[model samples]
Target: MTATRVCALSELEQDSAIRVEVEGVAMAVVLDSAGEVHAIGDVCTHGDISLAEGFVDGDTLECWAHGSAFSLRTGQPLNLPAYEPVPVFAVTIDGDDVLIDPAVKKAV
Candidate 1:
């Protein structure tokens, strides 16, 4: 599938995550402290909580419900409870637009 425009790059605050859905797939779009953009499955692997509502530390998104920190580059949880890795999608930045294809996952 083609990449879908989720939101503007300017809409994302640095070091924060925002929830976005594309074709029924929930995802978390994160702008890291380094000014890099990342897209990962929104649901925490440990629970039904949204990762977008979690904390951003460097390149990881930590689940607010359980404190499992997931790597923004690979979606791997760095702590217990969440042993499974969320799907990481490819992100494309065009001008001010942030595009993501739910069908395209970044190979870790």
Candidate 2:
């Protein structure tokens, strides 16, 4: 599937995450301090919590409910209780637009 426009670059804040759904797939769109954009599955693997509502520390998004920090680059949880990794989607920056394909998982 073609990558669909999720949000504008201007809509994203540095070192934060926003929840967005593309083609029924929910993802957390994040803009790190380095200015790179990342897209990962919004649902936390262990407890089915929303990872977008969690904390952003460097390249990891920590699950607030259980303190499981998942890497934004690989989507693997760094701590206990979340052994499964979330899906990391390939992100595309076209001008000021941030695009992501729900069907495409980045090879980490």
Task: Tell me how candidate 2 scores on lDDT.
Answer: 0.94
Residues 1-108, candidate 2: write the lDDT tens digits: 899999999999998899999999999999988989999999999998999999888899999899999999999889999999999999999999999999999988
TM values, all candidates? 0.98, 0.97
Best by TM-score: 1
Q: Give the TM-score of candidate 1.
A: 0.98
Model 1 pairs whose backbones collide: none
Best by lDDT: 1
lDDT of each: 0.97, 0.94
Candidate 2: regions farther than 4 A off: none
Residue 24 C-alpha lDDT in model 2 = 94
Give the per-residue lDDT of model 1 (tens digit) for 1-108. Answer: 899999999999999999999999999999998999999999999999999999999999999999999999999999989999999999999999999999999978
